[model samples]
Target: MLNSVYNKKQKPSTAGETTQSNKSWWKEGILYQIYLQSFKDTDGDGFGDLNGVVEKLDYLKSIGITMVWITPFLESPMVDNGYDVSDYKAIHPRYGTMEDFDRMIYGLHEREIKFVLDMVVNHSSDQHKWFKGASSSRDNEYYDYYHWWPAEKGEPPYRHSLFDPEGGWDYVEAVDAYYLHTFTGNQPDLNWENPKVRQEVYDIMKFWAEKGVDGFRMDAFQFVSKDTTWPEFPEGHEKDYVKWYGLRPELHGYLNEMYNKIIGKYNVFAVAEGTGSTFEDAHNLVDSDRNELQMAYHFDAVNLSQTPKGYSLLDFKGVFSKWDNAFSEKGWLAIYLSNHDNARLVSRFGNDSDDFRTVSTQLLNTFLMSMRGTPYLYYGDEIGMTNIDMPNIEEYTDIEAQGKYQSALKAGADMEEFINTLNYNSRENGRTPMQWDASENAGFTTGDPWRRVNPNYTEINVAKQKTDPNSVLSHFKRMTEVRKKNPVLVYGDYTLLLPEHEQVYAFARELDEDKILVLLNFSESESEIELVELQGLTSEKVVIDNYEGTAVEGTCITLRPYQAILFSLG
Candidate 1:
């Protein structure tokens, strides 16, 4: 057994700065992403609501999460699982009233946990008042709130919409104009270049901050800017749409202006969901100058897959290199393997065996938490949650999944192949209700859940794992403790070790004179390490271990399947 050290008086190196500092509270915090509809159902309405989340505050506290990023609960038509917001200020009736949202904010602050709301400013539901008004007449004052154009004689703006089966152009017969929807036709992309639109968004953000929300998770942030000319790509098989501008040069200017005008007023955290962003793009967005966002989530590591379209089996080397290069001393990365938009990490990376599944999940948690950035945990992940393999299209709640299914059929994809793709890539995997117990409806509610609960909830749930010290839940608790107790784990420089090892993943985190080594066996087989390589370190201590009975010898250490070990060095 390893003895632990608690440095109570050790002041954090980045302490005493403004709470909004990119290097302050955020650096040491752990963020929990709550897919609101699946967390808890308080009104017995069969859907999780803000009040339901408030009722479960103790559960979040017990897990030691410092920040909570709630998926959008705004008024919507449910077209995109709350991503297509119809009203930014009003909470959906199904989720609860604004009062319920306010109560949640107050409760979180009282518990010292920051509340971050999802800001889906890139697009709005076509049913939104603004979009409805814009579509009513071409010359309406609100017309500029969305992208509208006259259909060109020869070609449409772009080929079929990525999220629409009908294509990119939506003919609004009411105004005799065509609108552009980068996503679904029901979700018209917002016209960010419009000054009035910009102000409205800024004011909306300020309203939330003033109402006591601590931060905002800017969703689809890179999609806010588009090419001025709306140029079309040449006919070819190229994924890179250079002429179709994204992360435009003007993006930084707009972001800085918004930050200063709305976000700068209160000490609030801002993390951009920078999907499809290059390393250089991330650097510009998160650099310590306080000009752009405090931090940004990168998808490079998560995008590693065998398939050209979506995620695939684990490719450890590819993931490590992406993370190692994307993060820097001046900027931070939001380390996450799964979120409400993607499949669960265990299902994506593990070998599909129950025991190995648990081990692999714990391994991912340990490796991610031990790295040099703030870590975000999706709900139910700590308990080794699996993906929901819904059988039919009607069982799906995500708009993207349904749209893609239609496209697959139109593109001549066979029914079997299309079903296989949906099984692996549907957002339903992450939207499953929390598995609280083995009872009917997984004990998340007496009423039916909005989505299906994982069928394995009986064997894998909080109630069962809470009593088992060796379970994945316990491992997660221990990992959180490790992060809080070690500064090097939170603010240190990260260096990857054994880049070429196929089965073993190793890395060292160094902060001044303190160094910590984290090693993991990614496979089900035992791994052997040469003892001499680790002997050069000055001081040593075993801080954490996933394998309970394993013994570490001087020169060599043996790691059981999916085992992770953390060692301290002076």
Candidate 2:
């Protein structure tokens, strides 16, 4: 049985009671992401449900995670997974009923784990009652519930914009109007400009909160409002079309109003998925004064690359510097190496070899968890899960990958090149079923999983890692313990040490009288550092190491391939 580290009403510091304070809970708390579809299947339905999550509360609490962020389980058409909601008030039948949702919420609360649900308000499935009524006729009271435009002279509105990836926009012949869809044609963008729509959304949010959800992770939040004029961008900047809809000057007013009406009254935690936002955008949304959200997940750090493909090659120094500057000047940042939408960190940053992957994973955890921000851990990240190698487009479930593959082919790219890119960068790599054991389907299900399990489950399963003291899972637990034991890591000032080191990352976190230094060797070879070089911090004791084990010395220290060390100094 999983160990119980938390209990109802136990003090936050004691591991039993959930903390109610807004001051530092976010700063010190650890958030775990649960992709419900692949977590655990109950009743052998070949899909994970709310009941499955309820049964795993003890497993989460045992790992020292304080917050649980589950992706959308609301009623949806599943056009883009659950992102296209048909009814915000109802639960998806495939996942479970509303009663099941309540049970999961109360169970999490009983275990002192705050449950966060995905709030997809940016758009709704075309089948949503609101969209349905609006599309039936322009004279309907719900006509203004979504964005709609009419073509001139029997021609459609400027086809210059690629709103729907499938080529054409949906039109209601009876109403003689076309609706705007930023993603799939089946998902229509909500008209936030309408007061009725805004009020309705607020009421829906309150309804869920009253049901016992502790918080929400807003999806595509920045795109809620758009320029109603639908002005066409200059043809010169066709490549930058995606940016035309984000962070309008009027966005803050809409967000502030929504927060005041729905989020403010409940005093719940909220984190927006500000996909195309800068640090300034984050500050405007989640400053300390709590004007908007409590925090936001920014994609700046994750966008770094090894090729000039998406954003330029990953610049370590530039990325760290930007983060340091942003957090110091604005609000706290949410640090993560991988999520449900990105490739695994181990595969992206370290040698594919198990030993090196283990070390690099630990190093990443230490660096991110020790920083002055909330840390989020993806499901399999704690045990060093690698990216799944998808053999063909048919094996992928993510719509973005499929669209990109077809687009690449249309753009004259060879099939082999497209496949290679998809294998390395597609989001499906992160969505494979969790590796729980070496048993069939990685022990994630009694039957076949919705998605294929990683073939490496035999070596990377959680069952084996939990029993091994030095496994990546154990290292993650140790890292969490260290964060809890040392207040410096929880509420400390972060200062990057030796920023000039090309292959080494070093930093110091200090709080009051306590100080800790984190050193990471980012390469597959040994690196040495003089004790005096660590900004007057003498290597008093090696608290943890990703190498063989922690070793203490007087003058200098050596780190093995992809190793990391945490030292406590007086």
Candidate 3:
């Protein structure tokens, strides 16, 4: 019955259709993510601001980014890089004023680029007026705005949290209650069960919509709806918060309520951070007729490959093929390899060795751009940026990275090796200042950056790549050019080619008579493209290639190490 309600009332009827006229910008457009603090800084500030993004509108437009998703630059304590919102209505002073935000939005619109702001509604900073007021006394008007358990009765109920120094619950002496925080103790989870709190979030969305901002990327969205009964984690599952702790039943109803109130009314899309979402949950969240989220960043596809241990091509194909089949006729997925929350793709998921770094990244980029659903490119990712070797924990500024390091130390793990792992896997990898040029601080800032710029910026930067046709940034620009001209890339039937390959990830996207095949050699060893699987669909036109010359030789296509070539099939 619930599925029926979601399907009949909310899911878009056009999802099953493989036509070019999907009429949804979210499914067709390219979404570029901007980690605002690391993007660019003006006024000599150590951190980047909204005004800094305004200055880069032309560059973004030139790169063919259709929409921009700006990370949380709202007023925050910076405990979680702006995820802990202290004020929903105000901009962080360090990131500039409300007027600067207005300018950035207008400038993006001027460049024909839609803007999506990070909507961190799952939790708020403990310093927020509402949270502060709620903790002050039980009699306060905002006392029920957050989740707090009275400790006077008994020990606070046991639950899992992704962030808590000691445990999930933090005791407050002022009110003799333990407040819940899905993240850090300073960030308390909001009570979505409370109608008033939900209304406040809706009002916040309305305000931003009225300001002409396009959409919201819901952060930690799965945790917003909890059981509230204070259920314990199942036996043998104590600290695994990501799996057993999210996607409660109440979440769907609440999201539906929010969708009807704001997103549906405003004609703007909402893409949820679907870290914990299962296949059915993802379908329920983004299925067109479902009246819920428009798209989601499902990690099942990327996680299979984005790790320091390396990944197999079969694993990569399996994950994406699973999603491709799951959302084929109903929901939508966000095609992204890197974002502000994860490590750099080239250094993590990709082979960033000297011989393969550029071409390997180009191959990955080609695969991402040619995939079904929208593609999201994180800042600095287009220029083949690799993770920086942050040798010391003292140089790290990410709260989660620090917390993980402290946890590792307490666990008595090797500190040196742990730091190495952090450098390879930390979210700070993606937070490094954007490599704009060969200037000091990579032209991101004249002043010292809030985070260190990657040292490879001198060779890998927008300014250098803009003129080099074979550069990764140029490859990205060319891929977008191809994507923009091909509707099949946006709304087409995806068929995995050579799924059992050991070092190649190839696939074809088809819409009616028009089809394009994407072939990627994910190895540093030269390989041959197996044409037997391609059947009679021969390469009609070479759309793009990372290497200069063609490798097609009759029935067998010889691919250079990490080479990628897209062909228009006849």
Candidate 4:
């Protein structure tokens, strides 16, 4: 079994019996994701580089982070923020040289932090040599490297382009054909059906693995294998497009091939961007005997709320509970609230308003840490960063936002309403410069930042929170500590308590003789929760609490606004 590597020794339970631990470092270790451009800047360039990341290795270790996933800094035109790979073997000059990358990896390893490279193989930049050759002439050796439809074919089947509202096919005059780009025109989707393309991708992985990259987060990989026949779908199929275009049966063969050729050879953790269209699809990709990926990273919970109306607590609970139940026995899961592709965690999930921000942020962190999977904490989230206000469309920097705005204009959508909603959902809201201190540009850079820093950085920053023991930063560090000490938190069974509770989310984790109860109040009002499941178990000492204190009596607890508490049960 793939998880056999996880078999180890666990902490002794209260019954004084030592149990075998199913703790995989990838499963037990907390992952910190660094949005490269905003993390820290060296050489006064206003852009973060590999050296800047090396300088902060100690800080990442301070927060109890055992693994770090840095976003793409590979050679690119920066068209889709390094997702469009121009050269797989070279480092972009803007970020730094190959030597810097080697040094950065060494630094992370020195701190015992595993490195996870963001592998974007779904597409390549049009400027890439292979793409350039493929586009130049149909007779070229790289002509079949990408998907193309002949101009004489009278337009390819309807395909959805996430970034380009216009369409997924772009006509290239040189080859008299249209190329497919699920994202933007500059990013042409690679033809995974081709054996050569698969080998090319495997070779790239081998190169990185040789460089000591501990793992690979396959970006947009669910969409990598497509139906080359380009079958047409009924109208509005785009709404549930993942079912239509993602996770084709053939993708499994390619994944198995890659696993045998690269992943298994390296013995590294591999997680895909999306968990196909259903639970069965997710399991097929990640089940231990499947010999494919190791972890399932789904967007069900994050996609639940994208508007100001907020999401239903019932829906939130259902989504998480259903996923946990699906993967409880066999496959593994990745737990996270927000990442580079979404808005700030606190702003979208927790209360980002002044009075509730701090406590609410801490509450969300508690939920993440106590969950049944590896928690991926985004950079700047430890300091409780809020979404920056971008009232105007002109202020947005993400290609997804800009391209979608153009599409809305062409569709005659309400421009004012669009910008307002985009402000709440634009990924750029989460990509702002990291708030390091109260200094200019929040001390992320000595030079003017590439993007505007959030004005709230004056009050919300690592420097300020580092001193306050009750601050969100400290709370995050403590949660990591608690999780590290409790092996049950990583491999224990999760049972959702008070599943229909309006303002409070409660759950319990248990492994053999050790049991833990976690309660979280998601709203800004004082809430009380009485867990029927807690009646038999005697509540022991508080393991960790977001607020200064927790009020517990019998089977009930009065939770203050955004209060979160975890208690051991005897």
The TM-score obtained by model 3 is: 0.94
lDDT for each candidate structure: 0.77, 0.74, 0.81, 0.87
Best by TM-score: 4
lDDT of 2 by residue, 314-384 (tens): 26656766776666645666778678787877776655576588787888777777777788888888888
Error of 1 at 149 (Å): 0.9
Off by over 4 Å in 4: 1-22, 532-540
Q: Write the per-residue lDDT of candidate 4 for residues 203-287, one digit (tens) a residue.
A: 9988887787778999999998888877888888888979887999999999999887877766477899999889999999888
Clashing pairs in 2: 7-16, 10-17, 305-314
Clash counts for the predictions, in order: 1, 3, 7, 0
**Winner by lDDT:** 4
Report how far residue 437 has shifted in candidate 4, in Å: 0.7
Instruction: Name model 2 segments beyond 4 Å from true.
Output: 1-22, 153-163, 166-168, 236-238, 275-277, 306-314, 531-540, 549-555
TM-score, cand. 1: 0.92
The TM-score of predicted model 4 comes to 0.95
Return whichever of 3 and 4 wins on lDDT: 4
Candidate 3: residue 471 lDDT (0-100): 89
Model 1 stretches astray by more than 4 angstroms:
1-22, 151-155, 236-238, 241-245, 275-277, 306-315, 531-533, 536-540
Question: What local lDDT score does residue 481 receive in model 2, on the 0 to 100 scale?
Answer: 80
Instruction: Give one digit per residue, the lDDT tens place, for model 3 in 1-570.
Output: 011110112222222222234557667778899988898899787798888998888889898888899899889988888999999999999999988887777777777788888999999998899999999999999999998889877987676556554667888888889998878898899999999999999999888877876778999898888668776667757555556667887888888888778876664788888746468777777766677787867877556644367777788888888888887877677898888878888887678877778888988888889898889888887888898887788888777887787778778998887877777788888888988999999999999888777788888888888888888999999999999999888888999888889988888889889888888888889887767544544445788889876646565787888888888884
